[model samples]
Target: MIHLKNVHKRFQKPEGGWFDAVRDTSLHVRAGEIFGLIGFSGAGKSTLLRLINLLERPDSGSVTVDGQPLTALSASALRRARQNIGMVFQQFNLMANRTVAANIAFPLEIAGWQQADIDARVAECLDIVGLADRAQHYPAQLSGGQKQRVGIARALAPRPHVILADEPTSALDPKTTQSILDCLQDINARFGVTVVIVTHEMHVIRSICHRAALLDAGEVVEILSVQDKQVSAQSALAKSLLEVA
Candidate 1:
């Protein structure tokens, strides 16, 4: 449901030179599939994710989501379309001043839902993320994982069709990361939402992604499916398993 056609992103360096953060990257994310983007730092993974969300517009080429040209839309129209896409970050990015319930209700409020509707949605979302008991708690009162749960609830508040996750599990410990990964998998399977996860952790990709692309220095070097036999992803996974044991 997402397409990037020959997209290129560049930045003006302090010395008056341009650095290409993303170069000629093109990929598609199908409906109901969890797509993973893997790379070392400086591989443009974050830049690529931001392109999909229009947080950074492409300097060249286009980004289209579910047949609408994102590059062609007005700011207001883009804002409306963005409601159909949700994003979670490594930092959780929760408002420390807001309670969990208020945080989850923020998107609904922006969407202009009725007060009763917002209340019901907030309750439902709090339950979905297993934070119903902490509805009145602020970010400072929650653990890292709990804060992230609130972030997830807020992202899902609009019932978006697509979810973009950027290193979502990086901030948590392994045990907490596993828990969060399981929760994300549940969200994907239960709702049929198309998920795009950008991470450096192969274990995270293996646990949740149906397919993945390996990016190297702004180039997508390989796209592999977990279900496909004799693929590099499978081999790499096998190697990792062998090493772990």
Candidate 2:
């Protein structure tokens, strides 16, 4: 379970005092569901995601994950906790200098897994993402879809309880995007990992999310649930955005 109550975030404006990025945001994402944070540019979707992992601390509020206060943890403790929280970026953050298996094994190595264990885990992850044949290949040699698959593989390597993806498909074409979304769905269904995705595209939410939180001007304006082929929206902003997307 993930919960944030009255969460707020601010940033210093370029030529002035301050601007709110996220304001009094509160939402809970249930375990084993794919939840989406959807909004247009500058809607604070990414910032809200950062707050969940403490990559960006909230100005004030409680950030509780599995009943643990992430905001109150010591640096070392937070680091340890993060091992079970995987992150997949918009750009596949793979190392150009490393092979696919090596890139996937990076986290296990940091956690001090033995070489044998790392190899086995990396192989399994590769197989899961359908990149077993590309284990020895470099990032530059892969297609965009292939790269994102590798990113998914790397994120799942730790067997994390939750996966946070930030605009992961924004860089891909339609067909590629669908494949990536399918991969995410597969992981959630097969592993029971709670997945929270940040996306501006409404089709993304419509396609895979069990529930979605709509944000506008730093605040959550609506929450939409997708079930039985019906999508209901309570906020005008959400309805408008849905129409546009």
Identify the leading candidate in terms of lDDT: 2
Q: What would the per-residue lDDT of candidate 2 be over residues 1-245, giving only the tens digit for each residue?
A: 99999999999999999989999989999989999999989999999999999999999998988767899999998887888888999998889999999999998998889999999999999999999999999999999899999999988998998999999999999999999999999999999999999999888998999999999999998899988635679888888877887
Model 2, C-alpha of 231: deviation from truth (Å): 1.9
User: Model 1: per-residue lDDT, tens digit, 130-227?
Assistant: 99999999899999999889888898889999999989999999999998888888889988888999988777767788988778778787786775
Alpha-carbon error at 111 in model 2, in Å?
A: 1.3
lDDT of each: 0.87, 0.92
Measured on C-alpha atoms, candidate 2 has an lDDT of: 0.92
Residue 224's lDDT within candidate 2 is 90
Residue pairs in clash, model 2:
none
Q: What TM-score against the true fold does each predicted structure earn? A: 0.93, 0.97
In angstroms, the error of model 1 at 227 is 2.6
Q: Candidate 2 — worst ten consecutive residues by lDDT sum?
A: 227-236
